[model samples]
Target: MSQPPLVEMIGIEKHFGGVRAVDHVSLDLFPGEVVGVLGHNGAGKSCLMRILAGAMIPNAGEIRVNGSPVSFADPNDAREAGIETIYQTLALADHLDAPSNLFLGRELKTRLGNLDDARMLAESRKVLARLNPNFKNLQDPVSSLSGGQRQVIAIARAIYFDTRVLIMDEPTAALGPSETAMVANLIRQLQSEGIGILLVSHDMHDVFDLCDRVVVMNKGRLVGAHRIDEVTKDDVLSLIVKGELPADWTARNLEAAQ
Candidate 1:
């Protein structure tokens, strides 16, 4: 049998007024795995992810981190537990440089409580160098950086802080192919270092190329999850829209068996 997941959710439910944003969703994420959460508009993907990141509290559920049950009171509470989310908007300060953005709220301080500029810069460079050696000039304003570079800085910040589980919502939604490829490579690097990633994406290509497993959510409910090797994009999309498995998936399975 496979090892237990690094993160597990049991009976997760979240409500906004009378509408159930997330309905009895259960998920497991293993270390060094990328699990894609794919759904169309209004499919509750963000709601479920926010709950996992503790930006939004669940009305009912049990969360397990490293096999120990836990509850989070706030986003900071989740951060303390190594859950980091990079939202679509990126949540980065445009006026700040890469190092500044990396250490924005969690700035390093000297023993006397002054900013430790050297330490933060060194850490930022080290993280970037590990992910992208071509990255240069951490002092440039993020607004002046290319879209892909900005994404790199945001992701570098998350990974550098030792966040075990990174939730990236539509990380490549607004980028060109080359930029997307860069972000995709960075993702692989992070996963190779044993990070668990929950990726929410509308792009089938991104999901297919980067995810080890695909989870489909439709109408606030999980339709199915299949290992990438077990199914095709068409099969997962059918489940996303119709809440039904592709008619040929069983036939495909049978052919593979023979």
Candidate 2:
């Protein structure tokens, strides 16, 4: 039999008082695959990803990693389970350089109780080489780096820690076209490395280009999931806006399958 997906969020629900921020949403991410979560501003995409990342507890649901049931007490628990999240902010200290940001809270220490700068720098370079070969600003503060360069540092941090599942929230947001392309390339590289990625984005182009499958959410519910090749941008737009499959989309899919 084939191996189970890298991670599964089953029947997830979250509520804030009377508001149902997420309602019975389910998502699965497989190894080496990128799944795009597309939705509007209040479509509950962020809430679902937050639950999976252990940033918030769900009102009702279960999370399975590699076919084993797991409950995360907090984000730290998620990290311990090989789950890493890179938000829009990139979560890097602006004053720090690439190596410093890469090893931020989890810095390496020498036997004499000192920072192992040489080892950290070498390891950072090794990982960055795989993600962004042109990245060579080792001592420049992250604030000095361009948008794409900063993204590289964030991704390098996640990958260097042996992340198995990565959740990227609007990674290309606020980036120029070229910078967006750079980040896209890094995401593709991560997918090739066999890491499962849950990409939450408002950009339809990024969704269709980078994701193997597109999952749509609307009004706190899962609208539908379509393979990248199975649906058009307009079809996805209809789902996002209407909270239902586009007219004739089901017919088209059935016809194609037959």
Candidate 3:
């Protein structure tokens, strides 16, 4: 039998005063798989992601990790459950170096009751090497690093804590070709280790290239879910613009319903 998904958000709902930002939506992320979430701005993608990241609570829904029901009070609660989110901003302190930023809030302390710089540096190197072998300058502040390097730092911090589910928002946004390739390699590496990833991105190329499955949303509701190989860009675009599934998709549903 197949194992349960690493994470499942079922029938999620969210509202802002009189506005319904997210309707009843369900999504799942499986181990060693990448699921891409696509939608235009104000399409409720961010709101849904925030709920999954524990930055916002759903007005109604259920969240499960490893088949067990969970309720996240905050981002820390999500982190404790092995869920990590790397927002678009990267969320790294510019003045801090890789080791410092990696262990910013969750610092390692020595027996003498002081910060363990040595241990932190060693741990930082190990994680960075796993993601970016060319990564050096562990002591240099993040402000001095390039965009890709800074992204590496953010991703490293997320996975350093035994992360099982990673939510990345616009991970390769504004990155150059080479930098984008580097991040892509790191994503593949993570998948090989059985870590499930939920990627929310506007870039269609990235979605087609990296994701195993694509889930499209429109007007706060899920339009459809499609396997990467089974659907075309036009099919996804039709869903985004018209909120209608492709003819083939509709036929498949009809066959399944009979």
- Strongest candidate by lDDT: 3
Q: Which digits, one per residue and each the tens of the lDDT, describe model 2 over residues 125-209?
A: 9988876788888889889988778887887787788799999999878678887887788789889999999999999889988
* Candidate structures ordered by TM-score, highest first: 1, 3, 2
lDDT of 1 by residue, 66-111 (tens): 8999898878778888999888888889998889899887899999
lDDT (10s digit) by residue, model 3, range 147-240: 8889888888888998899998998896888878877887888999999998989889889899999999999999988888767788888888
Clash count (model 1, backbone only): 0
Model 1 regions lying over 4 Å from their true place: none
Candidates sorted by lDDT, best first: 3, 2, 1
**Candidate 2, which segments miss by more than 4 Å at Cα?**
251-258
Query: Each prediction's TM-score against the native?
Result: 0.91, 0.90, 0.90
TM-score of 2: 0.90
Best of the two (2, 3) by lDDT: 3
What is the alpha-carbon lDDT for the whole of candidate 3? 0.89
- Structure candidate 1, residue pairs in collision: none
For model 3, name the residue pairs that clash: none
State how far residue 127 of model 3 sits from its true place (Å): 1.9
Clashes of 3: 0
Q: Lowest lDDT 10-mer window, candidate 3?
A: 247-256
